[model samples]
Target: MRKITFKTLTKVFLVLVFSTTPSLVLSQVNPSPKPKSDFWNHVQFGGGFGLALGSDYTNITVAPSAVYNFNEKFAFGTALQYSYIDQENFYKSNVFGGSLIGLFNPLPQIQLSLELEEVNVSNTYQDFGEDYKDNFWYTGLYVGAGYRTNNVTIGFRYNLLFDQDIDLYGQAFMPFVRAYF
Candidate 1:
């Protein structure tokens, strides 16, 4: 649909803008001779595939996230994720969520983050509930972690559905590659 196409375009644009933020900072740092700690303040963008634990199909999301350190060990950022999955009942769905992630970089090879997200879902072959309710309205919380380097990064995430009554949720483990600024 035109709307989904527009939204996807907007996502790509914003990711490019945010992912370039550190380049400006890097230029400043190069002239100033800043410490290695300045590297952690850079921006990160990641893309990869996720294996949906419960369904007949796997999920894939391209997420671009950024962080600004209030200090060396602590940082805050937002992640925008878009995903699609297939189910056994001939149901297919697309999801979008925004999360506030608290980032921890204990070592150069590892990064851990705790996230709280709101997710929205759309089912392609069936209605979400009995009445359809506009074929939308899904929200949830997600907690995830990541390990990264200059070449690639591996990530794992677990989610809890807060808007649905069945107490159902899902887990996604993703191995992604990212380009850093």
Candidate 2:
């Protein structure tokens, strides 16, 4: 006669049950493949917002973009954003920009990014036309970093302002926040 200890009995039971039901065993082994690599590759579309600080003007920026996630912590994407500013008491301007971005999320509570961007600024209500609109063409490139937590993302970047300003040709620091979905 043989005596079966509790551990031996449990092993025998599992083998008998699993051998009869492979689906049950397989289900226990797999758990949905790790959540599709962090929203960009999984979600078809997403959006974010920013605050642009410039020497002449400050503006609120909003953008909607398509995201492609490389993994659980990184993404590559593009955004189309419009900007507006209140300049010099009764002066205003509108701008449009496009950015190609790479995002790095080291922790779930924090994210960092670098962006290459092109911007165009158009002043509508100034005293002069081509003279004031001379500041209109703002083709530039920039590198930026960002932080994110609780669905809100904040970021900063320095840009090489190009093809427009002669005397004021320099970089600008921009900080922004947006809801990530």
Candidate 3:
């Protein structure tokens, strides 16, 4: 087996960062002489949720995010994510994570986005009259494209470094929705 070291991990991480940074690193346009008075101006709220309930299974997810639009074509933001799952007589899991998000719109109806995140996941279970808990770090790097409208954004993203065993996003391809405030 190949032993994974911190140095190797760091190099991989740096490469991902550098490759995505350029598109989002452009200079911001100078603001107009008259600024808007409303605090909500140029700001937007967006996120997604999932819920499932059954006799033997329960799952809930709440992900909230905020973004500041630099212009019609550029924006930067952050996201807070949480999810909980329980299976009767089986196990329970909890997840918490946050991501730095960057978005760019090259056209009026198309948007490209990237997100980097670090997630902490914990699971608890009982076996043979014994209880145990496990915790680990799950990192994600995603690249996506969306269809934009006046009030909503619909997108699909693929996690470039998703791990089937540790990541909260169960599938590499995930759909997302966002509404503007």
Q: Which candidate is the best by TM-score?
A: 3
Q: Which tens-of-lDDT digit does each residue in 19-137 have in candidate 3?
A: 97875674353445576676578899878788999999999999888999989899999999999999877788998999999999999899899999888999888787677899988
User: What shift in Å separates residue 171 of candidate 1 from its native position after superposition?
Assistant: 4.1
Ranking by lDDT: 3, 2, 1
Error of 2 at 57 (Å): 12
- TM-score of candidate 3 on Cα atoms, chains taken together: 0.72
Per-candidate clash tally: 0, 1, 0
Instruction: Report lDDT per candidate.
Output: 0.61, 0.67, 0.86
Clashing pairs in 1: none
| lDDT-superior candidate, 1 or 3 | 3
In candidate 2, residue 26 scores what lDDT?
A: 73
Candidate 2, after superposition: displacement of residue 144 in Å? 3.4
lDDT of 1 by residue, 1-181 (tens): 4456888989999999999988977877756675666665465544334555653666666666776666646667777778876665556667787767776768767767677766677666655543222245455555556776753546766554443342224324333343334
RMSD of each: 21.9, 12.9, 23.3
- Quick one: how many clashes does candidate 3 have? 0
Full ranking by TM-score:
3, 2, 1
